[model samples]
Target: MTAVALLLTALFLAPTGALAADKIVIGVPTSLNFLEGKEANNSVKLAVDEINKAGGVKVGGKMLPFVVESIDIRDAAPGVPVPEALLGIEKLILEKKPNALVVGPFRSEALLAGMDMLAKHKVPLLGTIAMSPKTEAKVASDPKYKYVFRVSLDAKYFVGYIAGVMGFLGKEFGFNKVFIMNQDVAWARATAGIMTKIFEGKLKWKVVGHETFPTGASDFAPALMKAKMAGAQVIMPVFDMPQSGILVKQWKAMKVPALMAGFISPLTGPGAWKTFDGKIGGALNAIFELGNIPSAKYPPSKKYYDAYQAKYGVPLEAGHGPAPSYASVYLLKAAIEKAGSLDPDAIVAALKATDAQGVMGHIKFSKGNQLIYGNDPQKEALGCFFQWTDDGKRLIVYPPAIAEGTIKLPAGMKAAK
Candidate 1:
């Protein structure tokens, strides 16, 4: 053969498509019995499975299937040390060597600790459920944090809705006094702080009582009695802990008259009524998403909800956790396709320019590399305050445009005339 023919052959074979397909691995280090983690795991699996079924994703002229690797970061909350979470992530990295992680540790404590390892290994992650402002603040200002991206609502994004709901309840019910029950964590504290400011300074409501409890406390009777005696019209508990289940159950059993709202994770799921054995009647919760309600302005939102129900035979537990987890996988794919390579730096750059629409809406990252929401009512995310009906359905009562029903007071309580 001629020398020129041999050179041409070499050039044709040089395309990356001729090489082995790239494997995109997802690592989820969630705690045991935490429904949010399981929801995220299943949601991610659904997205990955769908992509694989459709001939996988094409990158650099080659189709590559996604690979998922999950681990249990036991006791993964603020009470646990940061090093323990770091160890769990390190294990996943050593075992899987993931190209990218769509979901990571569930809370800010673990996320903050796991960032350094992710950066060192050059693994790009799109976090789904960690809601601390520090996660974005650090990534935005520090070059060391370039690899970490948050696709879910953070502290600032969620606080706006919570405060808005508090203001609405005040005006709607003529409730003039409020009490705050906050768990001692960064996300809860930040939410409580903003709510206090909005309820006191802007809404002109009296601050009746402020209570702080450690996570995992089963008894809320003392705090409940204190708020009731202080004449608080609203009781805002700002925490995502499982013990929050105890607070809601106790409130009903003890017959606390004040309205319970804000950061109510335990009450967000469909089975919550049965969990407490019908003890959570008339309880208000700030739910970021719901399948039945027109919570998401985006049309694809309903499609996601239907798919999830068909696959799992149950409603999504916490919409923020699973919805964002499923969306993050697609977002990562979009970024990789735009970049045309699996290189982390290129993917990060493409993510910065992301404006793709997902189940949540048209998702775009802010300067801090955090997903932005709630700025536009017609287009972006809008959280609802839902109260449980007597028949066990969550009825949206805030932001009248999409509300399923009006807010009804608990059987014994009356709104001011």
Candidate 2:
């Protein structure tokens, strides 16, 4: 063929500009049926929409929009086989070829499975939930696994905040003795151990009855009876099971009213109050965020909460849910802009140097890639402890510096029938 004919052929074979829309694809691999999944997905949507409206992230003088593609991992239970859980992330990476991945597996086991795959692929992962300390420890243990970073508070930080609240409960409510109850899972186990140390050693609160139940244990009556028998002034539950509603209901049915707080995942959402038919009232619990809480140092939090309620018609669930996921997107955008490139290594470095404010407060990365927010008593994320009032509203009651209300023990606690 003549040179002119060859040139024409080359022109035709070159990549078409028609398919070239500057956009970054983020892959989310999680279980949509679960709370974390729904919250993270929606939060990411909110952030992406906001960023896109504001002209997206600037890369090499070109603004690139972001699109999130999700892979449903189905129920994120710790009992699910690791191989099966890993497959979701594998499928997402292989099918979507996203610029980064936001990992929000509700179970620690699922996060563990996804971690290895993320490290192998060298894709930067920003984990929002999955608070197992083991995840960050693994990353710290191996330099090759630096690609994984947790944007949410881990178990240690969470337990620390819980301990702080327990101390407050002891001082304010005159609760000298407490009972410990938790699930057998890793996160709960770690929380129980930490609380044990804090109560028994540091704070000098007596730990009376300690019980561990399986994730789906339906009967907490025996445990409540034992706690009351032991004269526990407070009953703390460290759990992650959806069936925690059973425990709460049993607590009320048994009328064992030691001021309750710890592993409050089940009570964080507004829907939970109705789900349990308002039985959560008078229950003191630790929550990571609330629409009007003072720990939400970020000015946009109330706006985010209002917008979420307006959009979903329910209060925003606090914890490692919507807030962190929403903030993670903004954090990623900041990192990408700081890096000025889409390369994984560059983005990872930028993430390490992250220092931005979002709905979750001023997000900054510390040692082990842990995201620190607000004025935590510890150097990690700020923790908020709240109590559900008789009026069906949650009031912040701990960390006196930021508390919006005082501790209110259950009505029948003194009688302890």
Candidate 3:
């Protein structure tokens, strides 16, 4: 009788012990595509470090240490015949059986390449920079893709933000005709499509000119001259930082009359600011303004900025890439605690149920695994417009509540006569 009782007790506790032993692994497949990738990966590292320092993730009444296994796959060489990095990632997933995955600073093409593997494994992927709708389309059609998610907002949200900024410009400053110049990348093309739809369909604004440039083109003089010739009052250029900086310099040299505005990226950082000086303005989804950090409302922002500067020796840029990486880890932690288990399904449920405040404001997931935050007053993607001061300082101009200072049009691009 005594032996029977002891055996039963041991069996009852065995499953609990096994459950407690499960460790939650998070795979980080970060891009080395450019300097932006480096910045984003550093932020991810910082977030993981903070979480580990806090004793890792808790699951089933036991604490399981979180591990971040990073894969660096940068396309630096031409025709070097690199192996498919996603296959290696798949192998890691099968062996480690991670609870979630953090993907990309990689190009859309690279991310598209990995979608099949991720779907096959049923692992959730939160991307930092892959923002094309096609990526979302893949998840929507795949029954196995219930696990994939992205921290970055889609093209629809981006267009909505642009519309809001344009509305503000029209109502407040009497600006009308606009020109849009977009790179031939998936993201840029999608953004241009959305902008055209909103301006033509909803706002009834005239698109004076529309132009597309090949990605990585050295000079933008021809495009700028064409926009000027078309009588465009606002020049909205959608390109990455390096090329955008070159465009700004060339536009200045060519003496284009249109004022510049566009989405913010690594190009709007201090490095780009130093080069472009007084020639940038647009809606910024992320802005690292010092005055915006009021301790009363956002204590964590101050702490994060201070710690980031202390560790990195430079101020953090206002880009979704870095902030989402940090927020995703914390979000994962919250989900784990809520689920009380390391099961992926349970964690996913917890994540969907989240209404927690994160560094990038409130992060809540909808039924389709889409992030539902950042909707503006027009029920669109919420973003604030900002302009570079003549002295070259970035300032929040729209949304009076968060404005650090008033919006000032560039010298040559003042409201149309």
Candidate 4:
């Protein structure tokens, strides 16, 4: 074949630019090695597929499909050095050259380290897993970091939701004494500390005890027993690891009289009903601003929830990760279409002006704050406080406006003795 003919053939087959199957690339630089990172990435992919099927995004008067360029960064797995993830971010930004980045880094350390990199390249990032409020503070203080947006649960939001539930329990059941137990991690510790302040200062409740345990630790007996002995009427457990399954089992086997509430990761989703063998019944769990269980409660969340379930044959991870990551993809599409161009600065401006409904509810990013707006579903992505019913259903039990069930004494609890 002639050289000119071969070159023309290659150009026709290539799926870039405005020729054949053109696409807008979204960079997902995260720890792909673990569940949270993996699921979050999957959610991003799911959104991409949905958008592509819906005729993609219109840009430059042509519809372009969305695609993802995800880097392992060792999958943002825990204990991985921030520098390692930072290098992956650089590679993804410079090499992959995505139009926008979602699910940027799994670790807060990595997120903080990569901020300058995202800004240097002017690639907007929607971080869906880093919980550090410092990220928000950084965005608020510096103009250089304005390209970053946080869709993850800030510690304040998690602790605030748990505390809000505790407040509800206090008024509903005449409960007062509270205890705090946290899995030894920066996010958990920070949240627990905030819980202490809120429990003591605002609620005027007695904090009978405070404890911390390392991640992957088994046998929460010591902490559970301590609460029982301290006359703790309620115990708030701050955990995100899988081993929290052990904590739930111990809470039931020991028959502790106190109501177990807080962000017990294992008990937050529908699977927990079986994973804990119904022991999680009546336990209060915090499902980050995204809706709980089926991940399809709210119309927006339901869309992704159904897509994921249909594609992967499972429900969404009701954790701090996937929901927002999924929503961020749609948010990116909205911003891109709103900007009517692929320019980074224009997209960031449109993102700041977002008022679309997302997984939990309406999503509106704060101008400089860079966090999702408000604590109510009407104004923002309100986190849900849910209880697992004995019949194996998750019922919203807080935020009276959305409450599907009232606060009831946890099923596994014994009468205060």
Query: Pick by lDDT: which candidate is best?
Result: 4
TM-score to native of every candidate shown: 0.87, 0.87, 0.82, 0.90
Question: lDDT (CA) for every model shown?
Answer: 0.77, 0.75, 0.64, 0.78
Clashes of 3: 0
Q: What lDDT score is found at residue 283 in candidate 2?
A: 82
Could you say which candidate leads in TM-score?
4
| Model 1 TM-score, 2 decimals | 0.87
When summed lDDT is taken over every stretch of 10 residues in candidate 1, the lowest stretch is 289-298
Residue-wise C-alpha lDDT for candidate 4, range 1-417, written one tens digit per residue: 999999999888864333433678899988787777888899899889989999999887789999899998873465678887788888988887788888777677778888888888888898887777888888888989989998876766776777778887777777789888889987888888877888889988899999889888988899899999999999888887888878877887888888888888777667777787777776778777664334333566666667778888888655667878888888999888898788788888899988767776778776554556345666777777777776878877777757776766754454432
Global local distance difference test of model 4:
0.78
Superposed model 1: Cα runs more than 4 Å off:
1-19, 75-80, 184-186, 253-255, 288-298, 375-378
**How well is each residue in 80-163 modelled by candidate 2, as lDDT tens digits?**
776777787888888888888885576777787677778778888888877777877787788777888887777777777787
Candidate order (lDDT): 4, 1, 2, 3
Instruction: Give the range of the ten consecutive residues with the poorest summed lDDT in model 4.
Output: 289-298
Which is the winner by lDDT between candidate 1 and candidate 4? 4
Off by over 4 Å in 2: 1-21, 289-298, 373-380, 412-417
lDDT of 3 by residue, 1-417 (tens): 699999888778764224435456787766555554565666666777888888887776677777777666553223322345565566667777677887563566666777777767667777766666667676667656666676656555666667777777677767778889888866778788888887888777789889888867768788888888998877787776456567766766776777677763545555556655545433232332221222223355457656666789986664556666666778888887898876667776787787766655557665556565453222322244566665556566655544667666545666754
Better of 1 and 3 by TM-score: 1
Write down the lDDT that model 2 would get: 0.75
How many collisions per candidate? 0, 0, 0, 5
